[model samples]
Target: MNASAPQQSNSTPLCYSINSPPFTYNHPIASAYYSSIFTLLGLPSNLIAFIVLIKSFKEARSRSRSFFLIFLGGLVVTDFMGLLVTGCITVSFHITHFNWRNLDPHCHFCNFMGMSMVFYGLCPLMLGAAMAVERFTGINCPFTRTSSQTKGRPISMVLLVWFTAGCVALLPLMGVGGYHIQKPGSWCFFLISYKGNDQIFSLIFSVVGLTSIAVSFLLNTVSVVTLIRVCCGQDRTQRRRDHEVEMMVQLILIMVIASICWCPLLIFIAQTVLSEADLQVRYLLLWLRFATWNQILDPWVYILFRRSVLRRISPRSDWSRSSIMTLYPTLRETIRRLTSSSLELGEMDEMGKSNVTAPPTLKP
Candidate 1:
């Protein structure tokens, strides 16, 4: 071998090393604090979402109700997963105590958690897209319902969402695209890097993310248009139309929020791929972290605004029972007497009819 060749090979490897110094002490401190805040926000919101959805599942069997519940459940699951993975990474980095090279176990855990977080994060959006499509089909095509009206479509949509999310997440494990543990740390992410086939991975992620956003936008738009046309110049009852409009509005809003939260991250990824400016890349990454926080916000929006979800939690009897009992201590007795009187009237009518038909039995 030529004497100079070894020197050139050594320099090539040096260029690949990520020498970006640690983020400033203040910056890391701020990020760690923010991560804690996000964790706290996500945990409670997900708990509420889980409870609301479980209650909804117990009460109703309609397609709309079932789909909404499934959507909320997926949201809670993803948010919790994100919180777990992201919070762990933040905590590890905050104290400056991690030794990536020595701790093989933490490295493996980081990789698994990172992949899971990405997988779950994408799962809810895919489910939301499926939901919009189901709603559109149900409203626009009445015959489709006549053929199969037992909530099959919504369930199928939910299954498809989960399957698609699993496939997307497994892409990394299959070696099509893989996550990397950050240098001198156990923190793993899908962020752009010079190592491995990062460019290809980044491209693939951007394409998938943007395509999902576009589909959501299209589906939501069509649903809104159909809802408007159905509600306007119609002879249907005002209350029924209003309810339908409200549901459509809620679905559209959900899609819009998902798109708004995820779109920036996709655009930033694409920009990072095309730009060579380090400052621009850093700024974009900062914003992308903010957008990821949107996952936490999505479930809370559903909990706070969706009337169907809220109504399932608070039944009409629940509202009236306490007040009625407080106002009249004998309310239970009154109800019992009314029920007994109705039963007695029915029994008397039955006996009189029997007597009329018992001509020969009168001798006995």
Candidate 2:
């Protein structure tokens, strides 16, 4: 006989004599079922959020409107990515009975999908941190007093957030610890595989995820607390102050809800990476997946449904103070000397002799 035949005979005897672990379909079924539910919930919510963000951007003028629209845009995009990628994996697991060995195509897809999801997932959290910083600075140094303008800052901050998130998500592809295809079917997530020195990978992933989450949490907490203190202490005699307080409260509610939805997922992700045993692993994974669905849902339910929260001003429609001067004749002549328009001076000189008279010129 050939050398291969003897080796095959020897391995076959051992393989037949060995007892393999039971293949449980329960984990795959549960994940698939719930993942479908999450997908259904997420798709519609993200669509609504996308619509609302578009509307808000079109009508936005104030700094608050601009900031909120940016945050909403990032939220909707990332959540949609999560729903698409995660939802597919869930369905595949159910259909194949979680057989990782036979799905090479899925393995490749899962790696890419997981990488994209992780990157996009970080967008909203980073945006939340940026929003908190913006609000805090706005409150502590009102635009009227602060000579420095924020006209370009929000966009710049958003770009930076996405860039950083992208860099973090790419680490896994570079062999720096990220999701990898697990055996028996379906991809496994967490920093380390159970087979090798996965603990080191887990440690790195946990540290990074936790650090980002903690920073976001702390920033948002401080922002809400500071806003509450200022609003509560401000004099109620001013109707404008009361209105401002109401707006601040609404903003805080949105931030708090976002944080609450995301915090659990972050905690569980860290727990999974840090824990060695399979204790509650499947359950925690399920719950974390469910919690992630909130990233899609919150923007739709909280921000989109409450469209009235956006300021009523339209940037293109509203007349500037300069436009107001041009629209009315009497007001135009009164401020003609304050302007550099020769046409306005000529008009003022002619109006000086007319029934419509300018106000008496005052000394500087």
Q: How well is each residue in 1-364 modelled by candidate 2, as lDDT tens digits? A: 1113323556421111221112443556355566667777787788777886798688876666566566657667777877777677766676756444334322345456656666666676666667666666666556543435555667788788889888776665554544544322344453433334345545554465556556656765676575555533323342223333333454555556655765666666556556655536465566566457566556655453342543333333324332322334675565554444656777888887696767899889
In candidate 1, how many Å is residue 329 off?
A: 42
Best by TM-score: 1
Local error of candidate 2 at 324, Å? 30
Candidate 1 residue lDDT tens string, 1-364:
1113323655421211332223233434245566667777887878777887788678854555665566667667767777777776766666665544445422355456557756766776776776667666766764566635555555676667778777766665555545545433425555464335556666776777677667767877887777665544223333234334545666666677777877777777677667743424345446656666676777766676655554577555333321222223475466557667878999999999887864455554
Cα deviation of 1, candidate 2, in Å: 41
User: How much lDDT does candidate 2 score?
Assistant: 0.56
Regions of candidate 2 where Cα sits further than 4 Å from its true position:
1-23, 28-31, 92-107, 143-152, 182-188, 191-197, 233-251, 269-280, 304-364
TM-scores for all predictions: 0.70, 0.65
| Candidate 1 residue-wise lDDT at 338 | 69
Candidate 1 overall lDDT versus native: 0.60
So what's the TM-score on candidate 2? 0.65
